[model samples]
Target: MSELLKTLLVDQLNVEVYQNRKVLGQVAAKSVALKMKEILKDKDRVRMIFAAAPSQNEFLEALTKEEGIDWSKVTAFHMDEYIGLQASAPQRFSHYLKERLFDIVNPGEVYLIDCENTIGDECRRYANLLTQEPIDIVCFGIGENGHIAFNDPPVADFQDPAIIKSVELDLVCQQQQVNDGCFTDIESVPTHALTLTIPTLISASYLFCMVPGTTKRDAVQKTLCGPISTKCPATILRRHENCTLYTDIDSCGAVEER
Candidate 1:
């Protein structure tokens, strides 16, 4: 195991800095696996939400390789999906998760956001499924603009009444899809997506946020130092009692240590 560069608490949140993305993923995956095992001891099923993106690749890879996780007892959900993408498109968040983790582990159930269907109906369907049980864990990544899921600053609502809804992507958020190589150009990215609202994501029993790379430096800084507002949606992490932010040295740049 690589040494953690720093460990600190920001209000109720726990933050850990690692040497690089690889080590960060390893440690984060270990923690997630352990938490799942702990939860399974007293619960019949563990419900988890995952983020699908290149930023989550490392952690998801490591997580699938963890030993002794009874994936058959786990039900999986994804945080968001591009509204108009074809189901078979490689850019589809469902496809991304299937290729990376779902197929590999074969969870007991996987409730994917059906972006090809009517957006409103899909939102209600998924929202109902999410509310069926309390979320045991949420493994997610912070966007370059500090958005969580597709909750871009313009659409983020800390007190949103709906659990899931369609949202227009901000320019910066669309550009990030290109930067992450998910799209060839900004024009190729979907303008809207169905996403779990801020309130929905923060409702999880535990949140493990994996953010890496220098491109995320500014967002990471704002997430840790800025006021808890919709401007940087990830700032809500500060309020979650069991949330942990795992970052590498590159992403933590310019943020003062406690």
Candidate 2:
């Protein structure tokens, strides 16, 4: 394993910096694999949530190839999905996960948020499923605007009561989809999405946040140095007891070691 450039603990959250995305992903995946092995020691099945984006490419790729994980004993869930995108759409978050992780691992079960269903009905259904078991882990990333999942600054609620909800995507959030090359243009991105709320994401027993790229520099700065507020939704990560933020030199731009 490559040595980390720096390891900072902001309250209960751990931030690990590496020379680049590939190394960061490898280390993060190893950590996740070890955690899964530990959890499986006493549990028959583990539930996990995943983020689907180009930013997660390396991490997910490394994770699927990690040994010791009985993929059939894991239940998979995705963090968010565009409201109108078809299941076959390459831009659909579910399709992204299927291609990158699910197909390779073939988990025991995969519960995807139904974007084609009635918004309210789908939220209720997915939320109910989430409550059926505690989430063992969540692999996610911070957006350029500091959003987590689809919980953009304008829509994030730290004390949200619902486990899942439909939210209108903020302009910055929509533009990020384009910046990540998930969509050709801003107009092509979905205006709204079904997302696991802030409270739901934090409910996981462990969180592995893989954020790598210069584009996330500003958001990373605010997430670590700014106030713990919804203004920079990713800031809430610092409050989680078992959350770790994995970053590369490009993303750790101005956030000095603590």
Candidate 3:
């Protein structure tokens, strides 16, 4: 909340640039926590979908430090997961989320993709849970390939009918795993993943997209400037009514230079 470097609008998406990821995270956490409280004022529970990646660390940590939000009344779900990692693998998206966020605040219910299950069964199961009730909030990040969740350009569908489906990782998306230090190399990253489709993620009432670091500069620029197309899948956010994009000076640098 310190003097924001800049704030602008791209269609329906609101972009706010902060001094660094730390401030970006703190501000996003506060805004999300406040929205959660507002939703809980009338509903007994809030269903939130969260993304798993190092980019989410600061915000997740700051959100745990937030006060007045009844974490026990929140139902948590992650947006995607790799198919091959062992259940105990630290690199697994589910494991990453549990260690950082879920185990800390302990949402009342937590739903995650099961890598052990057949891709078909798991997708159907998670899709059911997702549609059981309307999603209140989605906290996510855009990939270096401009992906949302694991909805990489090659497999992304702007109007996907299936709520969840299996997707082959695009080369760029696979390399991003190594770049983020989630995987030691491209081959170690799973070729396929189960992700909530674009329609599913965009269905949420509110969306908070945290994108930071210098590596994300081009993706951020495409997300804000390109035509709304699957070529830059995250560009779909521009059509969302209540989505906010939080960026640090590093990630916002390209747009600033424009």
TM-score of each: 0.98, 0.98, 0.98
C-alpha lDDT of candidate 2 relative to the true structure: 0.93
- Candidate 3 collision pairs: none
lDDT of 2 by residue, 55-140 (tens): 99999999989997998899899999998887789999998999999999899999998887898888889998999989999999
Write down the worst ten-residue block by lDDT for model 2.
249-258
Tens-place lDDT per residue, model 1, 1-258, is 789899878878799999999999999999999999999999999999999989888899999999999999999999999987877899999999999999999999999999878987888899999999999899999998899999999999999999999899999999999999989999999999999999999999999999999999999999999899999999999999999999999998757754
Ranking by TM-score: 1, 2, 3
User: Candidate 1: where are CA atoms >4 Å away?
Assistant: none
Give the TM-score (vs. native) of candidate 3.
Answer: 0.98
List lDDT for all candidates, in order: 0.93, 0.93, 0.93
- C-alpha displacement of 4 in model 3, angstroms? 1.0
Name model 2 segments beyond 4 Å from true: none
